[model samples]
Target chain A: MNVTEQRLPIIELGSLDELWFQVAGTRCNLTCSHCFISCSPHNDSFGFLSFAEVERRLLEAVEWGVKEFYFTGGEPFLNPELVAILERTLDFGPATVLTNGTVLKPEWLDRLRAAEQGSLYSLEFRVSIDGPTPELNDPIRGPRTFERALHGVELLVQFGFLPIITMARVWDESQDAEILGRFRAVLHLHGYDRPRLKVLPRLLLGAEAKRTCGYSASDRVTAEMLVGYDTTQLVCQHSRVITDRGIAVCPILIDSPDAILGHTLHDATRGFAVTHGACATCYQYGAICTNPSSRSPDAHVRTIDRT
Target chain B: MRLAFFGGIYNNHLALATAIADARSRGVDAMWCLGDLGAFGPHPDRTCELIRENNISVVQGNYDHSIGHGLNDCHCGYTDPRDNHFAQLSYDYTLAHTSDDHRAWMRSLPAQQRLEINGLRLLLCHGSPRRTNEFLWESTTNTQFLARLCDDFECDVILGTHTGLHWTRSSDTGSGVFFRPPSPIHQVKLNDGGLKKTPDPFAFINVGVLGRPENDGTTNVWYTLLRTGNDVRGGRSPLPWEVEFVPLAYDHEQLAREMQDERLPDEFIETILTGWWTTCLEVLPSKERTRGRW
Candidate 1:
């Protein structure tokens, strides 16, 4: 490690609270302009995780006391075993699947709905849509992709699944209220009245670096920046991503060579150096990758006088 | 030994009064409250008055901590904008209505309380034993994690109430299809609907809340009653402590009418009347949220 890298803050894995699987790997059907992984139809640098591989990780996660499981990919539905994978996951605990929402089918939804009902856990779907209108969303995502994703949302709602509509903030931060207002109105028009929305900060990596500007040298998370700060806000403190290559530090940094920590969950318990520019974004927006239900309460730690 | 545990009063004086009487009628030897005495209900002082008058032991909840120290938010751990908006309204109202003496008393309350009943060590807290505001939702929290909490805290039973839901997970019951053994190799045990035997069984119980309906479409609220028999064949009691979730019905309509009079948000009133949560929907895990009418 270099001098600056040596001085970076090392965050230990507090517990294996969340276990994520890169089910589809870096191969998405839609080439979104701001995809941090630069995933595309032809971008097959990584490979899909087979059903057996996912099951192995699930069993391993139980050993670690994993609280929840998440499935993501270029699109998780692109894999034929996606349905079975989620069906098996509910038997373990609550499962969430992150998808582009364009490739979902009725047959898959039917089985997932039944599985969720049978299990004691919940099955959540997070559908990615950039903005409220087609004009705003289509540019970042591909053309006509807005309407197709919206249909997917309607289908999920029809199957009694309330999908959390996740959006990457492409507009100015001040426009969040107005954009969310319009997004809620639009979702209400479609069947999702009580829409759950999550706004993600832009991760300046991969395709996003080429589309906009990459993080400058000053954007790194320094060791001084973490003093007295709740490091639990950082996803690396309590989570790990399982890819076909190995167990990565987190989902956002899977593309980085240094991100892959080990071949097994037990091997990946070592502390990680928060040196990447994306780590700065994660620091600013605490627990950005986790479901709202799973987010830690450490950010609100206030010193109260008991005397 | 018979003990009654109340969770999250939320300034609902009517429910608190009803619950206290119900427990008394059931011949409870001791009464304990899991804090959150103020929020989303009218007459914050009334709830405090009832607790003090009845001499109930209380552990500080996030809302109680915030109100005691005059913090900005309830620290309920809501991330959604809409949830925060409603939470702010409830906190402001509770802070303004709570008396200074009650706030001082709340400030003196402990974060967690430990006691031994019938040879069972019980740890009572507003949320998890580690954090005052941590949410231990049923669908998201796994058995091994619960076991770890019990082991770390050095308790056989961990009773918490923060997610406003009532549920229980026993170490021996095996929550998922797979049974987690001490060793990783023997993890996969297809749940045959029979409880697995464990040498040391721990239990984590979210003892429901008296603050509001559990988003289960019922106006009636819930509390927990833990009872242990006197028969002791071995070193421990012959039978384990039995947990019963007692649903108590109060005059919810009167509470709703009072809230409307105090100008509390209509959304808060809707939950009290309809028994379905109209706000704070974001913090719920999918399993809990799916069971509710938003």
Candidate 2:
């Protein structure tokens, strides 16, 4: 009962709605400056999850009535068994994977499309790009990373997959319309006539913390902030990430030691204390890592319509 | 016995009128509307009038609840800024035009309804039984989840229409257990000699909304007609109720003109005329979104 711990609000896992797997761990091809995990080929503090490991959790998730499964990391495809993992997941429920869109293979997409068609679920590919164009995106993700990612998008579209282009908001909020419009127009030029875009708020942590200003001391979710707040807005309320080491509270805070809740999914179901500055960002922007298909907290806003 | 289910009229009086006639022509014993009486289309009161005149049993949708209680937003639960802006515009138009009496009637409507037909228990709801505005997409929703909903609600069939798409999924895997007692625990005792392959008894149906055309490249809206049969399933032995998705073709030009006259966003008018969703596109799952013309 430290006073500091007493002040931090505890968020309970309402339900095991979304189960995440840090499949590739902190291993990525392009070390994006804004990457919260600072994932790079050289940085291997975290490791990839084996196909068997993911399968075990998929089976465990069924009993808990887990709604959906998500794969993320430095890059899930970096794991040799990523395709096999997704194919297995579709057997249980819908699966979504977060990748940099730079390293997708055609054979992988072909196999995934057949698997999705064969199963009663969907296999969603979420491709990440910082900005719409190379001039704007290269500065954050790396040189020529935009073209490579866009090429991946073209491949996905060729395989009849509607990839959701996930871009971290590195520019002003007002630039959203212009950026999205340009991205959509660009995608159309590359045969992705109908492009899906998700603009994510930048998280000031890990590599991003070094790239820009980290969260200030005042940027913490306090007990006072929980007053009449919809706790579901916080990912910890309905989700848990299964890292190579253990299950963490959320995908964003995997680097934090305190983020590790337990060794198993059941143990991870317990409440988590929102003490990190990243929690403040999660507080401001709900549904940070969830797929658009999954229900975001705001998806349930039922205020009567006086309009 | 046969019954017709209409989802989300969305103030499209033309579609509602045509769908009602179509349902009646099919000799449906009863017609039910799965709420969402207003928003999007023009003249909210006209759709309300059609509902009252047609004697369609209605359940409360998120839009109905919000409008009935005079809430600030339609509670459609859109996340994108562009989607919200268009949603707010539609809600404002619907609210300002709707009469207080209709709003009161909407407030009085039940959130969900249960009916028994030919020994089959059917639960009718706006979205899902768990929440009013939940989007239970076809590709994302699995058989296990639907079976769980059926078990929780204690119904053989659950019908909803919040996603504005028409699709049905039954536990047709032919291997998984279909019947489980309504309990929080997942552990359940299998019925009918335990290990015998039980027929897929539970069904989750999303009767496509009459509000607007589905994002499919067709200018026709859809509804659902469910018919009762012996064994809920007869010759098929496992297939319980027969579900039919009835597509209704309305005068798109007229609807578009009405929407335009109402000063609704041109985006909405574009949807009516083109059958492609131009706004509120963010809520659609990738599977549903990919099929659309954007």
Candidate 3:
């Protein structure tokens, strides 16, 4: 089919299973070279979401049957009310925070530990540490970031939390086993004996697009690609990100103009056209944004007759 | 009517036997096994045999689907490398040990079962009704989502067991109960006020598994005893269903010893003996994980 005849695949919101907040917006303490949104200390294109905004969204999320809540940003902890935001969120459902892991305070963690204990929901801390060693991660994330993030992981462990250490894949795929082995050993040495590690595929957007190569003109999800496919594997099928500007289709595409769906959660429920190269990446690696526990296990097992 | 729901036997035949006996003693009218008949335990055939001998209705779980079709992995939905390593170990062992006869039987099991008990519509599946390997953790699953599942499946209750943790969410309070009719004609009719009230209060129950300890630092596994009759709430409450999570204490030490003899991972044996999950920890939500001693 010609470009004019080719139709972009449209995926409807399956269920508002995950509602994420760009709490810190496009602002971070450290500007990693491969940062997707190019978040840095100076970047304030998107500002912090106040406690009231999160509370309003939390209440609105209940109406949508939102299963879980996620907090992300240039750095979620950069938001002054982040701890309180999370504390209030636990009242609604399980809460997961994606952080650079350098700005954590014992006082904040103490309050969070108490909040989690009091509530039925779980408070998950996904600490971003690009690699196991400073030599590998420091150049990408910034100087001393690796040590700072490791100390943050140590603090989380000390606070009785099994933080999921998230790392962006900077090396080749073949090095995964070796890298993970070394990562585990490093974590064990720091008293995190049973550390949880999550390796993320690099999203070629923002700073990463400049670091690597951007998506080519041919990179797009076509309607034909979705036949008999488990669309639920895609993040947009079950999640939406609430940003200061408005609601975005997914967390990874907040910078894109078309990514913003609407100002309200209800208005954002309209079907999304998978037309971006980033969307193709989401298709290639399904559920890249969601926690492992939330992903459907039989997603790839198409051989079974699920009658 | 009283029914017993067992989740994920996972080759723990000892727990299955004890739970069956205990459920039978409770005067359950029917017994059902939500699948995963093999994993993390010894002698997959024994669990399948017990389910067959007892004549319990089975729902196909991801593990059952994998083993039946000779798939590569258990599809237990663990994303961590360590978790997958242990899962593969368990899946390989179970696949090798399960008899072809039992594997065929597993292949024949339904993905989900719909039943009507005393005017209440019930759906039983290994996981959520839509997907067999879906994890419906109590803390993560909201009432509105459960209501939507009930509406889509046209059931008053959904009994599933994929997450291994036992918990229930009820949509009786009329929150998040939007009507998305199955057909466009029904949607028009509903909009025209043919059906006025919101969908009836429905529930999603994860009938705790017999696979292993609930990662709650206890050797005892659990099953669900669902009762529907005049005796429910002493006939005072409008809701007819009553859910009772029955904790079943079995010879877990024996199961662990058997696993050791079977050369299963020490992690599996440790969970059985200590009642704290060593493997498969990555698949647990934070609340569930925090509750455990791991």
Candidate 4:
């Protein structure tokens, strides 16, 4: 085959360790400028998954020995059936939900807290907030989202939930210490004294691509990159995303048409070619979507260069 | 066959001594130490001396690999800056104190061990079979993922320890609930090619470490004993086998004092004195973190 026909680096599914559900689909209450999928209140390209659909996938996941389950979308809370879905998922194993932390209700949190307490697994909430304050966060995430998300975080803490506050890196890398210090202080003031925080590398896709120049043509994972790399560091090696249409390779690639590999989890277990610009980001920051408990890929750790 | 497994000794020579004595007193047929022979404790040479003297079969942990090859860091893979700072302090201390001969021995250790005991293939690893430094916490790891490990590694039992917790999950395919949706939500049950029955059962055991207290507000650390063999009747035992987590108390005060004498971080001594982890808290899952005082 010629260079055009040659395959990109193909990463085989190490194991169906993480099973993700795009529960709310491509819709969000606050449309962040850096939204990888450009999810918004009106983006209906994809749709919410019903409780029955989620339940069915949960059953399928059990046989595959999936280690954990995750819920994502425009905002998982926007789906009316989300609370029920999470309640059901806790029964199977650990569950995690990625949200903008703007559309939560106390009653739902109460019921979910009870469900999590009753189960033998953990239910993790990852709330996305771009920056420490509105000044830095508002421009990326829409106006007024900072306070609303903070309120949502406060609600989570009230119900005995230690939600992990996730921030997309938007400023110079040198400013991380100051930004994180400010975030911790603010969170402490809001009653979250010991806040768990995660700073994620920005993915240059969707709205982000348009907002800040898209990826260069050379920003693609090449076959040579796999020579000594531990492929397991890449999410595509150990995770698959469930969408309304079908199962996709990973949460980061759902918007790519070729990402939908098959209708079932088993069929989707085939290798995925790292052919897109987002693949480079995934390579740079490994297993970016997995819960802290699941252990982030070692590729992200920057230590003294031993070799 | 009766066996004892130790996880992440972490240079706690005193604890390692006591646990070995206790296991030997209990009539264990064999003993194994699951790597991580150094770190977070004073006198790294002492633990190395004891393990070598006792003939403990070992697996190479991330720390062991790093120290053995003179790597810069312990490679515990902490993402938090504070956690990494403390980890580097411990790693540098350990590397500075460990003897060259011991590091060479660690370099010669295998990454994994496969043994057949009582007709069961038991695979011993410092972490998960696939990765040496992987953290397999009890609350976060599930049954199917373990079953897949068994299938891939082709073992009846896979034993690993790195998360500083001890737990066991039996993938006995015969257990009717092996692949069933958990009881609370079983409305949509489906048998998607459930586990097939085999002659023997499968299991995964995290033989808890002897390095430090499990952050359970107790000064006692744990080791695991696997009891497998025929019963008094000379036929196969009715329960097939048993997994027992043996917690042993040691003179942690002495260890803490020794650490202080060596000018080790107060944080390390605090964990010994209080039985609560002060450093390396970043890698802990929520369940484990919540259980700790710090």
Give the residue spans of candidate 1 off by over 4 A.
A1-6, A296-307, B176-199, B229-239
Collision pairs in model 3: none
- Docking quality category of candidate 1 according to DockQ thresholds: acceptable
DockQ of each: 0.48, 0.38, 0.42, 0.37
Clash list (residue pairs), candidate 2: A304-B66, A304-B71, A305-B66, A305-B71, A306-B71, B232-B240
TM-score of 1: 0.93
lDDT minimum window of 10 residues, candidate 4 chain A: A298-307
TM-score of each: 0.93, 0.90, 0.91, 0.93
Query: Candidate 4: deviation at residue A199, Å?
Result: 0.9
Angstrom error at residue A216, model 1: 1.5
Tens digits of lDDT, candidate 2, B31-122 = 99999999999999999999998799999999999999998899887877788899999999889999999999999999999998888899
Each candidate: RMSD = 5.1, 4.2, 4.1, 4.4
In candidate 2, stretches whose alpha carbon ends up further than 4 angstroms from where it belongs are A1-8, A297-307, B116-121, B173-200, B229-233, B237-239
Worst 10 residues of 1 chain A by lDDT: A298-307
Give the DockQ ranking, best first: 1, 3, 2, 4
Better candidate by lDDT, 1 or 4: 1
The residue-level lDDT of candidate 3 at A56 comes to: 92
- What docking grade does candidate 3 earn? acceptable
- Can you write out model 4's per-residue Cα lDDT over B1-294, one digit (the tens) per residue? 788999999899999999999999988888999889989998999999999899989989999999999998988877788888888998999999999999999999999999987777889998899888888887677666676677667787888988888988775422222453222121124243343544236788999999999888888999999887652223333446778899989999999999999999998888888888888876676666777876
